[model samples]
Target: MNEQSISQNKIENWREDRLPNLSGKCFVITGGNSGIGFEAAQMLGRRGADLILACRSTQKAASARMMLEATSTGTINLVTLDLADRSSICRASDGVRAITQRIDGLINNAGIMQTPKCQTADGFELQFGTNHLGHFLWTSMLLDRVEAAGGRVVQVSSIAHRLGRIHFGDLMGEKKYSSTKAYAQSKLANLMFAFELDRRLAKAQSPAIAIACHPGYSNTNLQSSGPTGLLNMIYKPLNALIAQPSALGAVPTVLAAAGLEAQRGAYYGPTGFFDMRGPVSLSHIAPHALDLERSARLWAESEKLLGISFLSQD
Candidate 1:
């Protein structure tokens, strides 16, 4: 159907119950062992989608799998994926490739928030390396399979992206670094990658699409994962009052992944109170996030850092 000539037979409120029966669909979710990612996996699993949880710890993965097995109708599997390490991601991708020839969807839901200044295994800034570059390589390696299945890529960004600056001059944050600022840059990169990937996919006439979402003020261990500080202290009480539960927080992600209403390059998040907590809807895309030149540069830099190219022979 044309843009204006649309059918009313599409999903409006995307919730777990409304998810289409995904009987044979297979999805690989990063950080699926806990919080929003786990919730998203469970929701999709209930709808009959086979789940591959790519986690950093096999113990946690097994626990998540055991929990999901009880409630979901589909099979649950796990792969060790340490997004902070390039070799780990490659091994994880290889493991996933062995399991499924085609992937119905890929949820880049793993991330680290404001954390102490650190570098990944490859010496890149921890947040940017794990959140953006890791997913970039992981997705590119699996793009062919996703395209083969006409699947979608769901990238989970955050509201903090509004305050981000790429810091290209010191991308590693070695010259100067602030935890919050670095986190913002990583999230912003996530959105930029989502939009650029979709553009590239369309240009290449690929069937797969790249979509994005933010969980809003979900009270997950994401904050505690970094370092104990004021953010963590206030997070608990603030979350109790304003933050939605993890199940609710995962709605936007599930919408981006399984909802029929989602479109290529479309970003989704909560619709209420500064886009922090409420039902999922069309999210605001910052003007900077749409800068084509910056997007291209970021893509180029990512390839340079990762030593790989995607979607073209060159």
Candidate 2:
């Protein structure tokens, strides 16, 4: 079908439902203070899931916790996690390990958009570092615990990924940086990691599923963080007219996290126009995202750049 027709069908079919069995599950949602992440956390919490709100600011995390507690029937905890820093990721993971023996799910939801050109504490491009590498290390560090509990890992990607292309030589955007290109590249990395992880899990006979979802022009704080000036002006109105509400944007994530039929490496997103808005569905996967060679190379490069090994020492 043509792209226009495909998107219209998706918007028309959107729906939501409660998954009662999620009551005892444990979930960690990064960037849970606002936007799609916050809504996803709220929905899961309402269904009785114990949540860890991972954010860069403790103050925001605390506020989010209170909001969740006020609106949800389950438990919520705050944990400071700066995804731009590898050490911070380690510290947060250790903290989670100290308190809980099992982690049923992890939503790699924290990300930055078209911010000013910058580098992370780890020296990688800011968007790439926080959006992909940080989450990669966090997942690797928590893999054993997740495996023991037979958990799922959800990578919150974006439909913008369709326009992304990885520039291996300039991965850090050292030569030049366009905020939009960097943001898209980082998101594509996320998609690649999710798919590659699923393949690795299957090969190792691991029980965890690595799934991906996109929010499709959701009205979230992400749009507010655009590069400013003409770009912001352009995005603002476009988002206002076409973006879904944060609650509706959380559907694909909820489906990936708790849906009974969710599968490893499955991609989910809105069914509407160009996947920028609609009902949840099994979304199309980009061909480059499924390239095993690229995935493996990216995995190796990620480990090297982060100075962390994903495989267990044992």
Candidate 3:
């Protein structure tokens, strides 16, 4: 069957596809110290993939490494990556390059959620800067390495993207700010970036591919940490009552990163009950996310904002 047909038709049974032995593969995952990122890392490591857990916290990353080493039969290294800072991103990129020349998978999974109006270290809106712009720069820096390995770039977006609009005039939310809207826009950017990157890779005839996935409504610290006031209060109870386990939520991410049936530019996530939680499968892509014009505009704006030209010729 064709790749798209295989991925779509096997939705109910794809979970049974065992990961192949990856003794020599390398994967770099941002925010791998906890939540779905960590869960995905464990699954990959157990299958013998060398992992570079890019996290902001040395302590947490070290602890996670220890936990992974106990059960994972693969090399688990740590690198520092703070998505909110440009200098930090550059340094982290250098650190990753120092470790390996090729990456089998680069999981752009680190992100912030709804938060009070604030800016990143680079002075852009926190949500947009950290979630979208940060990953944009990081991926550009490492795209060549990924291409060398014929790898995949997995963008971990969110269901909130369904309610997002790219606020080009007010991308930073300086004119009017709503934490929820800002968060949604950032996630939409994530999914859009994946689609745009995949298109660019195809045009360049590069072997690398980009895929997107969401964790559904899995319980994670993001709810308590990012939101404030009313949203935080509401999420606390709702997280326990309705959220799925992080392990289950990480399934789609794992599939995107390592599943052989995952098609280029495809999106995967939960497939039950409003896509909040259930078995892993192909998921819907919002119409706005597929807007070729707007996605290209967002890509251009991203480059302009980040002061970097990315994938211009290749």
Candidate 4:
């Protein structure tokens, strides 16, 4: 077989026979109450991985927990986390620290999609602040715990990133904004963060690894939520026809978080037509995401904007 074919075969085989026994492992999943995050949590929970669902809603978290408890072989816990709020992120991190000393995996899965223009509590573009900066801060706070367990940090990006470019001159879209472009930029930031974090971890000789994944065109509330007008009108019908189930969409994320075959700095997603849905496999990383100079600048800018030195010791 050719190299690509060989890799595909290995991934297929690994999915079937080499799934890890996740007993004793603990994972923290943002937005674990619903959609792709919940589905990914289910996959890990089935393998005996203890999970903490960090969500914005207590009611949703409780409902998800009740459902998860019926099927999961491992502990199911909850913590309130509002990614739009920096104080909430800090509190959630503290809540996680109280629950577990070491997290085997930290899944940065919660995000807002193409929403109308707005700003976060921290005065950043809502999508960029919540999707990228929020996770940025949370991960920084929890890095020591993850490193303690030689864990993996899985960042959930998106195919929208393919068209994204960092607007360094107007990072927050303060002058003018398009929701689509803003969402794309945030997702791009997510992927670039994973790569940059992996490089930093290796340089520091840290045992923890960083990986990225996308869910392709998953049928989830994400399409219904946040988006309005034309975007909503398009996605609703398009999703019904072409989108995969959230369970299938979440496979790449589950792999990145728990699969032994997943590699540091790698990206994973469905390998089907237009990458909408199919078997889990390595996905394309946009050239902009691979731009080392831009990625490093983003890292520094993130620290400056957040007013914190991220991983300074490392």
Give the candidates in order of lDDT, highest first.
3, 4, 1, 2
Q: What TM-score does each of the candidates earn? A: 0.95, 0.93, 0.96, 0.95
User: Which one is best on lDDT?
Assistant: 3
Clashing pairs in 3: none
Give lDDT for model 4: 0.89
lDDT of 4 by residue, 173-240 (tens): 99889999999999999999998998899889999999898999999998899899998999978998
Candidate 4 residue 66 C-alpha distance from true site, Å: 0.2
Off by more than 4 A, model 4:
1-17
Task: Give candidate 4's root-mean-square deviation (CA, Å).
Answer: 2.8
How many steric overlaps does candidate 3 have?
Answer: 0
Per-candidate alpha-carbon RMSD to the true structure: 2.6, 3.8, 2.0, 2.8
What is the C-alpha local distance difference test score of each model? 0.88, 0.82, 0.90, 0.89
Return whichever of 1 and 4 wins on lDDT. Answer: 4
Better of 3 and 4 by lDDT: 3
Model 1: what TM-score? 0.95
Which should have the higher lDDT, number 1 or number 3? 3
Mind giving the per-residue lDDT tens digits that candidate 1 earns over 1-314?
11122223333455667689998999999999999999999999989999999999999999999999988998888999999999999999999999999898999999998889899999999999999999999998898889889999989999888898888888889999888889999999999999888888888888999988899989888968884588778777887899888999999888888887777777788878998987677777777888888988899889999989776424
